[model samples]
Target: MHVRNKSLTPLCGSSRVARLLVPSAACTLALSLSVWSSGAAAQAQGPNPPPLAMGLIVKLKESQTPSVVRLRPSVRPSDAAPSQRARLYAAANRKRVGFLIQKPTAFGAHVIHSGQFSSVDEAEAEAARLRQDPDVAWVLVNRLEQPLAGRVNTVAVPQSGGVYDDHFWLKDRTARPGVARFATAWGRIGANRSVAPVVTAVLDSGVLPNDDFSGRLLPGYDFVSEAQYARDGNGLDSDPTDLGDYLTSGEKQSNSAFSGSSCQVGNSSWHGTMVTSMLAPPAGSGFFGPGILAPLPGAVVLPVRIGGVCGAAISDVIEGMLWAAGIDYQGSPPANPNPARVINFSYGGSGTCRTGSATDTLYRQTVTALESKGALLVAAAGNGDGSVGVVGPIMPANCDGVVAVTALRKDGTKSSYANLIDGSLSAGYLGIAVAAGEFVSGSPGVTENLHLISDTGASTAVARYIRPDVDGTSFATPQVAGAAALALAVNPGLTVPALRQLLRDSATSYTNTYTTYAGSAPLCSSVNRANCRCDTGTCGVGVLDADKLVELALDLATNSPQPDFSAPAVAATSFVPQRGNGSLAGGGGGGGGGGSLEGVSLLGLLAALALGLRQRFKSGRP
Candidate 1:
């Protein structure tokens, strides 16, 4: 389906877009387990593996030091006590700064340091050594990671008719006047049009080419490396068509990750499309007369699929994310031709975010890398019903360096299912709370409140608008992401972090109108709509105040047009323009506006001098 830049060369064989195919976070985990002996052994066995190639992390005991860590193969039990084994484990990881594994389940699993490698050789060398050890049972490279959102499945209705009726979120609420006053913002900021096009990457279930995306959806890549997950005939080759992910009861039983399906076992949610639409719908596809993007809204969505029928793999998500940002992936995958300035990850897993933890570290690295590329990662707080205190923190969302979002309901309060970062909550505020991720019509709560029309089923012809009446942090995330894109559209030079700060500064507070009955879903009434339930714990800044954010961005643009360096922005604007000496004003320099007999202005002088220096360097002249 209209893959962006397919006109270039086919990623694999050209015949595929001539056909279509489909398939589909950060956490640093320490995987560095090395010792001098193992390094020597691995080197002897073969040439050192490429450095920075991802590898596995092995856990060590409290008394263990990398030099002292050792292991006993699982095949035979060691006669030594548990304490002794701990020392052996410590001995195994010599010459490494591996983090301690917490509540480890197996020899190398659980609360791991996914990637704290000194070098590829060191990591593989350790793996090699561990394999040879009689005590060591396993050593897996920290290869990939999976998404933890939309995992729980439900028999959702794919609403085929108009339910949201018209573009609701895009309008200024007559009642809640501050509710995303799009009308005024659009006028002040050029009506979601006028601004330069911004590329946003959606890393989730692959998106189908639907009329709604028309000319905006870019040709995206599928990073699913597993044949089962890919659901296509093969593994990882870059045909990203969404194959509807519906599972049979028997198939669910066979799957071990979730040990039979709980929630993520239904027809493909077409989740990628939903997230993409939130960013900006195709020109004429919105409930009102045009899509959310409207008249000339020029936002391009790059769909990078990482989710499959069983949800998503963390590894695939990581690689896809890297690729989407125009960054190298696992050291391979072609660099993205169009690196996104905004990235929306509306899916995440459950876990307490420990800064030094493996997953957290990887995620942080990803954030740094993307931020350097001028991309913002807006993620979901997760749909988990689990307590943050009991299970720890929700990942990706809880991970530092993202605009984690929480959901709100139409009546105006936290959605029961959405995870929150509220100070009172066990885990605390994870992100900003925006309007209920989605609104639904039909029955009391059936059709989705937001009208999203996109491609559906394995077949491309089935274009339908499924108003998925679901609410969670995943849905809430896109609003913030879209806002970032809109803000960038206004201030092309705004830094990602500064844009985020602007969002925080402009967020609206929520009153908890939601109350729950025992054994029932939480419900919100207009009466309690002003019960404000946000704090530093649950809401990042507060609810998304779109109009206010745009106003702030507009103010920034007016006050200063130079690139923001304060968040001190670190974009790869390390970019340099080729040297040129185009004529400026006529040599006469006699115009009233340009009355200057001087040869050149200070800035112009610097430009000329820099170009001269470059020429000299290139010529190798003294």
Candidate 2:
């Protein structure tokens, strides 16, 4: 029989009565009296309570004390034994057993089974007991739900694999051609092919099979609902499947496009194909040349498809990122037979920074977890032209432990659309910039473009040099991602922070100047590049210098006891700044094709003039 404690109602709630009764009645009464006395004393002491009792003891005379009473044990055969109680308590406290529940149905919770009960009597008894409490929902005992398996393998896109061809020209050669020459020089320095094999996970459109990428693609999972076709009972597709984009606008609404015939076929834009090609093109593919510089020839490519034809949900993308980096999915992790060493995210969204957003939190947690496992994350800086650069650096990239990349034109000048760093902005913003040869000049030849047609038989617009003058930061990200693969190849143990520093320290410095087209020019000369220093404002660690980076990595790998590459100061600001507003005019209108010549014409002239002046100054003949 249970009796409600009337006096305790205003003090301890009904739920806690059972707990209070566990102690003796006299003890409970004493504790209550002590609490009441303390409150009264605090009031008398003018609001502040007196110090707690140090050595006070409650003493009762023998006459005043109640006589000790002994009662018969009330044990029943049906009652649980002490050992059984202990086992139940242990199971209740187990972290994995508890199912996270919510009032309304929201996602992100898992259910676990405590094994089948022998009879409904036991199951009903548990359910009735738990239902009486507010925290616990009905505890139904039934067959457990099957666990969802995550994709672990990835396949490389056929024909779409190779190192960046530095031969492509941009801006009619107004800046220095040193980057290309540097790549060539680095190749000759015994450092050629010194890169270690690195696994790079591509979280984008699905990959299609081709003869060019034989034995290169690893098995991967497609999370997009439409790509359910790529999903096999074992988890991911065994064969490479074509993936298309979902149009965000037009006749097809959100769910409307999937039913059409065109919806079933993949689009020919080949954004993912283009990006992978730049990083790891097949060997002996004359499309680019005899070979491209891929540090990890045997490095596995894990294609976790999060983005769909049109775009992808932030949640889906986050899950893909976490899964690719070997984070558990929905509370369970796969065997992770082939975990990625580096994750390449070439896509982004237009969103502001916020604390609790799913995208932001997931990105932060994912990066921290991945880095702890010795994996590095590389993301595109985005194509938006906002003041802060790429919309808060777009999750994961903007997150603390990940490296963000911005694009550079062939002339070594930051692309106009590329995000810039301004002094007014805070630190920890803007992506590290790298040269992604101009889109127009780097377009594959007409014959090559025609030859590499998609399954749809439509000409890949990305492969064609249709827009002679258009530029975007989107085209520049792959250069940095590919470079990171090389860095990892040289030093497999390099941490995310160390890799970022190494890239910055070994970067090539250039004079930063802001330029404007005929209609976009600002009147203030102070707004020009002369005022903006290279390593100061928007130019993050200047531009990437592959040769210096390879040298640094090799030095670290050989364990020569060199200076600490992990030191923040040495890593962040080692590159020297080039003085003056080094602007090259003429690629768009200055009357010449945008190519390496433009860079030579502008930077070469400055280099020669600087050399001649130094010689004259030394001779004292001026």
Candidate 3:
């Protein structure tokens, strides 16, 4: 099921696309520069388009391409430019076909050409030949996979923000941890405004331009790989603008692409718009008062679109995350000048993440790589309450090194629909909680009314409306991300663990006095499933207190150095030797250097450390 905006109320009238004879220059430019392939436009608008593979994702053995040795006979492919590396490899292969970089990817993997095969047989043969090379680690065809997000079947009851202002959540006297006290923190950290904008990436559905994000949004990349799911009449280019994710009734029933996946017929959620707006809403929009990071002029949001009409794929999400953090690899997109210090995930799939699953392994490697760059990840703990039977937070969120965020109702109790982390099974990844409003019974406040782009019936006509009663863990995630940006503004050198601990330490304690549920709501766990109270073990350390979080950050920056609780790696294990035939020369199971040492004992850790240092010394990686 999708964690989405539950309701929508149209504010203004719709205009027909044909009625506008002279479209604005901006609109004309967007159309003129559209990157639709010859026939891709027709297919994108069709009921269903076959899943397409851009190429094969291949990982290279790191030792094979170490820093070039002077006056060496062996030619170093890594020394060449990324675009020219293919030709260099081809020369090394004695005239055989070689792979070209199709797109950049995370870990040691990169998306490479599948060759000019006349048929499926020819393609497989080429892949097999490439796999036999000593430099290649693994070769897998990039299949089209979908992320888990579907619409919730709920009727819309139109409500306006007239009763109370749209920014009610900004300061709710009735709620615990009511709208993070950003104002109090701003007073102390205002001097840090001159620093460069702390880039925070929002990896979700593509965003649309609006007044809320005037000068704050960076030109982000769209990672949706397929034309049909992209819904933009183009495969993957540079544009990250959200067209519309709305699906037609015919497509939902007739198209296997939409019918077979976790997709349902619904209006475009404008999810990205809602998320970014929360981070930097206009200063004095009479409706949406101000955002969490509005005071910090140096904080900007990067809108990296990982999902589209259908959901996103695991591969695309991983690629987007790495690209957002400013890691350069072989990719079509230009280098990210404004790499994000904090990345926010407002979407997730179901189920607990496994240790050795392909997706899980890839995500772990990506996270480790990002951590090396000093970036932090904040993700939504899926919206699977007792009703959905999901035991813990979903993948990526449950992945190590990510700060998973769960939701709390206005009154400071666990949200009725938020997925609770089973601490016993979570492996110490339980995350913080924030007040994402629940307008249902027993909750004290109204739902959020945020401005977002919505589809009008007429094609080419889109308008901004205030979506009422918007509630989900999807919305709760950005609060923590914006807070992280604020924290980074004060101290640019904070590590991932430091920011995580700071958020937890400054959080408000959970309140036991529920307005309506009283003593009925039990502590949420695998056994008690739904509508339960959250303890520190299951939900997080405490409710997010932006005011306290920033105060602590400023104090740490001015008074003393932040504590370092990290287990620093003693050696690099990824530099194993490569055989002459392009295979790993030693160390079985693909040169196991990047494996997680989370639960290893001190003795085991020391033994591994000694072995790793010996290997590093042998490989000459001082």
Candidate 4:
């Protein structure tokens, strides 16, 4: 799914590679990964059944040069650079294979080598030798780490001023105990890294170059290649502006050959701008707005354009995601000059990461790569109005190693449309939500406050605010993102994994079942359908408490890895969620586990829609 414009919002391996397995016999079958399907199965949505290993480390058993058997002496002590010791070993091995970065430091910081043995025999021999040697601590085959997307976007800065507002999610109480108390957290963070800024990436519809972002918005790239949806008349370009993705009835109907009912016609929502405002609103900039990070120094916003009027292609979104993280793809836009420390993807679809699936394997590799870089990826759990596990397993959100954030209302109850969490505890860590506004259908003026006013990146008009802003988990994700940014800004030493744990640990707990806007039946839940009205993964350990998160961040400023404390590690691929209505939920909200309409996916609705309107090439417009 692509980024939602205020709405809630690939790999190759074989003709279809789906899983990666290490040959248990070692070296006998070096780099073995293969799967196939005859005529039709190959054409479906599933990946071909083969697994590919990208990287592997093998040490020579003899003095074949400092003994490829060079042992780490021990697991390297905590006081010592265990990561460095491992790297030195890797560097030595790499040197024999012409590898670069010979010097290494820190433990668990093994270098990701791109070399794979040429044949089965060679790999097996090396694997056998390494196994027999009493040197190495651990040998892993999942080595090829896809680096950060590309060079990060950087921006120059000036000074500004503003007082924290009561409505600011970071400071004020949204009539809920789960709110982020950033104002309090700032006390510790502010004094430590007085000038350090945490770079944040806003992945969404193009953000216009506006004054609100003054000296903080960096030069981002436009990854949407489809000219029609981009409305720019050109494919992927250097410009990341909101080329205006307005749509009409005809576009959603005939011009696009879509279901008229599933699509909406309207002007672009300037989603990236809205999300950026919340993340790093310009401080002391008048009524334009006060942001979660804006009040602080050293926080930069990187605007990455990944969607258009018709949403974005999954390919483009991934590319943008990688680029923002400083990993360049195909090398076109060059490496990100200013890679962000935190990436906020406020949209998703009803897809899933099935166990033993090739797609899931590849997703894990990428997610792990980013985490290794100390970057935090925060995503919306989804706004499908159903259980996320039941309706989703959405990209990034559902993918392993990502922080999945659900949405909540000002009253600390589950938002009617928020998605519930279902991934396992460790890698499938899920985060609860904070104020993402609520819309009352029957009651008028029940105004839900999730306001973060700022300049419409594309407009010349002054700053403005949304009463009950187009509500969705899309909005809630940023609150977490902002809180995270604050933590990093104040304490730059936190690693992605540690930071994620701190956020999860510090969040306010939702002790009771959450009530939907209209008091819907049966709240949401992870294991039992009888317990929730619209559960978003066990209330996600509670709402995001900015103050508490900061406290945790301060305590963990040393960047130590936290012990895994999560539960329900999303079972390997077997997704069978129990829906409130008594149906065995599927990913994407289908009768079984299909696609989720949870947040902002464009899977065309099938209410027997007299045939109307559509994340694949990742889909939506509002």
Candidate 5:
């Protein structure tokens, strides 16, 4: 596999990279809060309006040709197709709709331009008319999707004095809910040198290979199809390096090209870098600490650039998803050598799963495709404000078979920024939740939201960009993905549904603490949407507990009944429903688990079982 920036050494080992940092300085400086633009906030209210008149992505029934006039990219001599006449529809009350038939996409959809419209409403009306055509299978407006996170308040200052621990969430805690007690889990992962490196794909803004990633990056493809959004001077390409996504003042003007575009004008969010580093930063790269998956022998991250300055188009996102799962679909880019076991979608927008709309059908189909490949899809529940009137988590998160994860504060109550299930049948989506904080203390009354994020648009420069007080479901999503990767590292054969069950089952219950930064909090429901406590039925299964998750995975590998050892394992379609107690559920199928126990004897299985039991009992869950 081709790794980006193969010459760059690991962050801790590279003196050259270290020179880019400032002397160990510390400051409690308060930076201005750069919140999401109103454009993004408007997206939470409904499905993003399709680009004014760029085109609509539509899939046709098998062997059916479009009746609308097909317009090719050019009318040059080399270009074959020209304008063709179509059947007239008086009900549409429009002349012939001219279409530019772009190349077929990886998801079997065709991008076509059906005449430019005056407004989004006009375009949507045209789309509705097209959906009624007999040849069309499904139609998508090709709306844009934004990263489901925002900078609440962050400053890239030096570490505070005294014994500093940047990664406080990983350590075991007795007072409140902590992520994972890495003692036994890390030790076992470190000792297993023969285990194959697990790949977790980050589908976000493009990534650049920095020292923090070191030896854990795989060759990725840029799926952004628009040159303006990509800002890379070209469309899709092999290089997924992030060019600056920052929009200028001129770009946001009413007469500018970005006027109707849903993208907000802001600084380039090195989103992919931040998420990748958090998921698998090198073991000792940052101040004597490791990321959730850094301790494993080989924890590889596949960076698939699907978003850009204007947010990712739905077509691009689906294409990136299919490619990341290593599925061989028509018109896809080169096959991915390293297929991801756990795919992290740290971005989302407004939309429910069962809306019965074309968007809903598209997401459901794509997610189902990923599951068939035995890859688990983990998505953020979105950072929609509580005032939006609970509609459950955002699209894709509410999609079936997906493990939707919401965010919580260090106090184990729902983070005010995260969107959650509101106990309404319309808003109910079964999944998991995790405390989004990196540091939380009771007596000192301090809750620092620290994350390994990029403070600069310059992808190569490391500097001192440990963004403190970063809050969003975006930050919380990757932790779950990394924990899922760690579980897969222990048992590579865990099926997608089974992995979801194990992770949900092993999660720690919410403390149900009503106290929060917003003062006395109430329980969140379909109506109570403010700063509130989370219940299993409302938020998710519970807060993520990596220690218990890995322990249970180990137990399942040793104790589960052996299936046929002849052919590869096929993942089951349905999974065990969410529950509180930690119990292994769902049958396993293909997921690179072939021959995992082919040569091992019964005695070895028994020994492994004993080890898992010992770690579980002695790990001190309380």
Candidate 6:
């Protein structure tokens, strides 16, 4: 909301004790005694007259008692009159200062006491003058815009590889065996061993300590409050209450008035924990049986708790962004000392580009700032069932300078809920899609520690492990985030924008008719038809290929142009506008279908494989 000046006025009054001691008090007492003596006069006067004005509290002196005063406008009123009133009060009470607080008709501004003026008019004039200063971003009054206070509820779910199980994508050779092969090839070629430890920040619901992520978690703060929201004084807050669906709750679940009772931490699902585990697990833990990312053995996972147990307000999310990017907090300058090079945001809200809203502006600023700092911000494209280009990209993924990611199934088709990018749009708006994982059908694995709800609304806290199927855009985001980290590990000097461009430029190209995963049943029935074509922009440069990205980064670092890493050349006649959609029509296209084949030829492939083995040995990967 925006706040403007002209809504505030200076307050004027006299010292309270002086008024009571004046001759007026004696006269009042005499009149009261006379009225009591004459009953007829008291009856004629009716009830005692109401107070001239509401009593106002004012500070007098250290030993002096507080005095009640009435608000009164200063004589000789003018635009400058309020300043005069302020001057009077300032003089009367040596310790008191007066300010004219202005209220804005819209959005709140940064609250500040611009300056003190001698007269009410003078203060008003100064406010007006400050408003004209270009450097004065905003002038807010002395009022508080408090969000309804409430407790945040956190629900815990088992750390199963749900619908987007990474194991399926990593182990299954039948499905896009290419992705699995890429993983294996990446391990063998890039550096048979893991590279330097890359820190990845998961800015989502607060991550709890689990057997899966013990020592890997780093120290982080809760921007939600000064209190202990991250953990209680004793230990990790462990209230495991399950909250009903937000959309399905009736009168009992209305959050209209922020109440702490309805929102208790540790009473919700474990969405954040599972997502974090996917990116960085504890030293020896695994969600899908026992496989681990070769490079993750020494990696550190920084958990920036932005999302609350249930949900997060836009402000908290913005603060989380700034903190994650090592930006200033509460007027402090940027001091992350050790910032994470990769940021994973696996959550999004439904909204197109509405520039003026608080969420949009803050997001734009935060994303732009982070990108300027060389951190790749990877975000989920959202699970909404709208067309890729039209559903409006979920922000900050949709925000310029961010890597917007969508989800793909085992068959190379876009997930019904994943948002797609329009290839026809500018490169800034384009997004990439990748394999999320397999969807776990039925109650595959159940552990006895957690409770599962039966069809009849009964909850049983049994040691059951339900294997989840990986299907949402949430699962797909981490794959790209992890790949981006690998890219940075190869070339840490890459800027945020450059990394995004590299990812897009290096994406493999293909053609397939895109279909909505959440649309009409008829579309699903025709999934077997080859008529559905997948092409560039249709399936976001095809699933992410790590080997090609590393090679590109290596080329960038060495300043030597690798033939396979060469970018497409634009036709001389193609008008490349300074800031418009410009297309690169020719040049050997990027990795075809899955990735570039130029580097895969017998000799080149063998050499690249050898280099990968050398890197693995250097990086300490097994």
| lDDT of every predicted structure (CA atoms) | 0.45, 0.36, 0.52, 0.45, 0.53, 0.38
lDDT of 2 by residue, 583-622 (tens): 1000011111111223333443344344434334533467
Indicate which candidate wins on lDDT: 5
Rate residue 145 of model 5 by lDDT.
36
Report the C-alpha lDDT of model 1 over 69-173, residue by residue, as the tens digit. 111111011122354346445545543435433222211232233322223345556566654544443343343222222211122234433333444556665
lDDT preference between candidates 1 and 6, better one: 1
In the order shown, the candidates' Cα RMSDs to the true structure are 18.4, 27.2, 11.7, 19.9, 12.6, 23.3
Alpha-carbon error at 483 in model 1, in Å? 0.6
Taking all chains together, the TM-score of candidate 3 against the true structure is: 0.68
Error of 2 at 477 (Å): 2.0
> Per-residue lDDT of 46-74 in model 5, one digit per residue for the tens?
23223233356655433322111211111
Single out the weakest 10-residue window by summed lDDT for candidate 6: 4-13
Which is better, 2 or 3, measured by lDDT?
A: 3
Q: In candidate 1, residue 535 scores what lDDT?
A: 44
Query: Which residue pairs clash within candidate 3?
Result: 2-150, 133-582, 134-582, 134-583, 135-582, 197-298, 386-530
Model 1, runs deviating above 4 Å: 1-164, 176-179, 191-193, 250-265, 286-292, 295-299, 386-393, 422-430, 437-443, 446-448, 454-461, 511-532, 564-622
Residue 276, candidate 4: alpha-carbon lDDT: 74
Clashes of 4: 82
lDDT of 3 by residue, 1-622 (tens): 1111100110000011000100100111111112111111210111111222334555555443342221111111232335334533653274264554354454435555432112223434555666767666555444332122211112222323322244555553454443566566666566554533577898876777765567768878898765665678776668888765555557657765555433434445456766777786645533345677776674388888876554455567777887787654334256566778899887665334564444455566566646645578888776552222245566667887888887766556666556676566544564887766553533212353222222221223254344333455666788889888888877765666667778878887665334433446677776765556777767776777777887787777777553221222321221222222322221111212222232332333353446545434533478
Worst 10 residues of 2 by lDDT: 144-153
